[model samples]
Target: MNKLSKLALSIGSVPAWAFTTGIVLAAESVKVNPPKYSVVSVGALLSGLVSAAIIIAAILAFVYLVWGGLNWLTSGGDKTKTEEAQKRITSAIIGLAIVAASWALIQLIANVFGLNFQEGITIPEIQTNK
Candidate 1:
């Protein structure tokens, strides 16, 4: 499609918040109950979300670090530019380390809180005579 048509189509599409609100408000008096937790279970998707957050943060941090290193290598010993790049690399490492540590901390907290995200318990089966 032409650029103008693409722009028009994009603009014509309903904005997410407005569309969500329209649907939400249209549903009058609909109720949703909060999820319940059992003594042995945690909410589904919590662990997956935690791991996804760590992975995303690590990838972003690594990208920034590589960009910074390239900038530093190209600085030709210019003090200001080199120092700024060094700072960027340092901050990226710190950020990635913090993200990694946060993942560990979350697991520790989960264990302490006795939460398990597995949906079901497993049991071994016994062999039967043919």
Candidate 2:
């Protein structure tokens, strides 16, 4: 087939494809359930993200500590390797400390300001005349 004929043939099938797709979609009666929790505002999203970050940081810190311990155990009396492993352990401890301190600080600020981080912030909506 020539280019023009091929293009014409392809274009002619578009309506048939659309009709088939519409029929198939109309044949199904799908029900969607409402979500248990809905994110109503950006503040809620940020709060959720922070909570997830805290959990991830804690898990990562634990993994790093265990990895450092294994490295140290397998160092086999090498001073350089031992030193590296010690640094890793120190870093992991520092990371864990930072995460804890930040969480404490957030809690303290929340208490001082009477802001509820757990429930997240809700901005008042401004309604306009339709």
Candidate 3:
């Protein structure tokens, strides 16, 4: 019912209270620090990636499933090959779905763990470079 929880719900994520840790750990990483992409940015990026992956995988799985089904129907009762195609299509679809869901699940878990889960509202430190 607070601002943070409202913001989280608006952003389609779990309530901030669920995650007790503040996720603003600002230690420099070994690799390049890519322009202060904070928790909100990372969450948005992750959501986008997961959604895209789900759409793509769903499309691919559907195409293969349809192809396999039609091949089976048109094969004139070819039991052996038809079964093989069916099995392959089924496996592919299941695998793709699992992969897509896995990413989404990971994102949700990370949110619950309070990793990369802050609202983007931090003022930047003033630079004094001469």
Candidate 4:
């Protein structure tokens, strides 16, 4: 196989190898006394993941904007390069707007359902019979 094909194959296998390793390690480190899983905990985990993804996307959009600005500054009167930089900036701005809108939508939906996104999930105490 060619060098490029070999490189592609290696890259494709990396995630599989990492996943297998993680599974093996996790199995070996199994806890004797695991914490009880609850719907509230799952909801909290999902909420945290969604929040993190939105924050990461926003950060990436800002980085893209900065990169586009740098490109524009270094274009030096080249029309094509300037246009490309402008497009990049426009795309970044649109992405940021979409992220903001998604966040707002999530908040609106949560409010409509009477769920407090900031308060996190609340687990109810279970009383045991004596």
| Best prediction by lDDT | 2
* lDDT, candidate 3, 1-130, per-residue tens: 9999898777765555566677687887678565664444545665556567777877787887888777777878788978877897787778777877776786688678655422422334669989
For model 4, the stretches where C-alpha displacement exceeds 4 angstroms are 1-40, 121-130
Q: List the residue pairs that clash in candidate 1.
A: none
Cα lDDT tens digits for candidate 4, 1-130: 9999999999999999876733343345655754564334766777777888999999999999999999999999999999999999999999999999999999998888887766564545679999
- The per-residue C-alpha lDDT of model 4 at residue 4 equals 100
Clashing pairs for model 2 are: none
State the local distance difference test value for candidate 1: 0.76
- Per-residue alpha-carbon lDDT of model 2 for 17-97, expressed as tens digits? 887733343556778775778776887887888888998999999999999999999999999999999999999999999
- Candidate 3 has an lDDT of 0.69
lDDT: which is higher, 1 or 3? 1
Off by over 4 Å in 3: 1-43, 114-130
What's the TM-score of each model vs. the native?
Answer: 0.54, 0.71, 0.46, 0.63
Best by TM-score: 2
By TM-score, how accurate is candidate 3? 0.46
lDDT of 2: 0.89
Q: After superposition, how far is residue 79 of candidate 2 from its true place, in Å?
A: 0.7
